[model samples]
Target: MLQVRLLGCFALEQSQRDQSAVLGRNGRRLAAYLFAYPNRSHRRDKLIDLFWTESAPDQGRTAFSTALWKIKRTIGASGRQMALHAVGQNVVLEIAKPAIVDAHRFASDIEVALSASCADSIRPAIELYSGAFLEEFDGDWVLEERERLEVLYVRALTLMMRQAANQSRYEDALCCARRILATDPMRESAQRATMLLYTLNGQRGQAIRQFERCRATLREECGVDPMPETRSLDLMIRSGAVFERIPTLLNETFGTGG
Candidate 1:
């Protein structure tokens, strides 16, 4: 079984072996392109265009062939057992193990955890999402996939924050909320969660600071003010009438204090 780790950096490992050989820079990029877009085979011309954009047509094709050969060699593919192979004029990465990609597993795990009843189920999924996809790689596909994975990570953090807040784990909740806000400053729900947790943790000033941050974010980004729910929370916090509340979209009643 072959495994490709794309979350932090690029690492290709065979199940039986302890590690993968060092792939050349172009070789790594070629392999990553195939892994990133796995559903369909890519035409030889397209692969050349994507990776060797600066070279002449013939030179680009040669460069792509070189990278593909290196990728195959690095993954231990041979004449009969080809990991990256040509199907007609198009090439495809036909690895034996479908679950060899960490990004795929991370996505599947998060999907399961989202609908799961047990909070514990989500822990592994959250842990699997170590960082942005292809953290060191810079390309159009890498940027898009990185954004997608980062969105997933943020959702996991939001869910953890809500779970912790429901369990009265104020500190943990605040930690998660802060993490979410750090990733996306315009995340109003996380801003509100941080404020509520700050008040509950006996730091009313910090709670106010969170609200101010939210207000500024909203004004700058959307050219709008905080919603009624946010203002209501503001009044409650300022007047020392703090209760167990959180950000919500539809209704004013997020939750009643227990």
Candidate 2:
């Protein structure tokens, strides 16, 4: 079976053998786009527009055809199992059954987990997302898909973090909160959550330091102070009024205590 890992880097493996080197640069890009949206038909014209916008129509068509042909030649016999097909006015890349595409699988798993409101069930999907979707590529299409997947990833992380906190797994929840901040440092909610988690884990000093970091980040990045709620939480923590009610406080403040 062929596997395409387009999560962090581009990789192609067939029968446990690396085949990424066989496809040249253009072939790799063409294959990446097709496999990124497996089983869906992309209008040939649209594909041409996306890949060869600078060329004349005839020239673009030739380029698309040549690039696609090179991909097929690279696949050779595997083309029978996983092949590109012309369906009416569209081109479809058909992935063989049992083939793995990390991007597609991650999106599907995250969607199902979110739809079912089973945040804990998304761990597998979270594990699959090693990094940003196609971190090596940048195009309008790639950017759109990247952003969409990132939102889903962050949402899954948030849900899992809340679940962990509810279970009193402070360290795990803190890890997730840190990941969220890494993705978007401007996420005040995550910043606040991190601080609360640190305090809940018996690291009051660390929590206070976290607040300072948050304040500095907000001031440097947005030229603003932490939100009023954040400030109030900081004061409550410093006064030690909220220590005894950490669980209830987390629950009320961010739905983490459950």
TM-scores for all candidates: the values are 0.79, 0.86
Best by lDDT: 2
Per-residue lDDT for 173-248 in model 2, tens only? Answer: 9999998988888888888888889988999889889899999999998999999978888888899986777767
Candidate 1 residues 171-241, lDDT tens each?
A: 98888888788778876666766777898788999999889889988998999998877787888899876
Predicted structure 1: lDDT: 0.74
lDDT (Cα) of model 2 = 0.83
Q: Which ten residues in a row have the lowest lDDT in candidate 1?
A: 249-258
* Candidate 2 deviant stretches above 4 angstroms: 15-18, 21-26, 56-58, 76-81, 87-89, 96-99, 244-248, 254-258
* Model 1 CA lDDT for position 83: 63
lDDT of every predicted structure (CA atoms): 0.74, 0.83
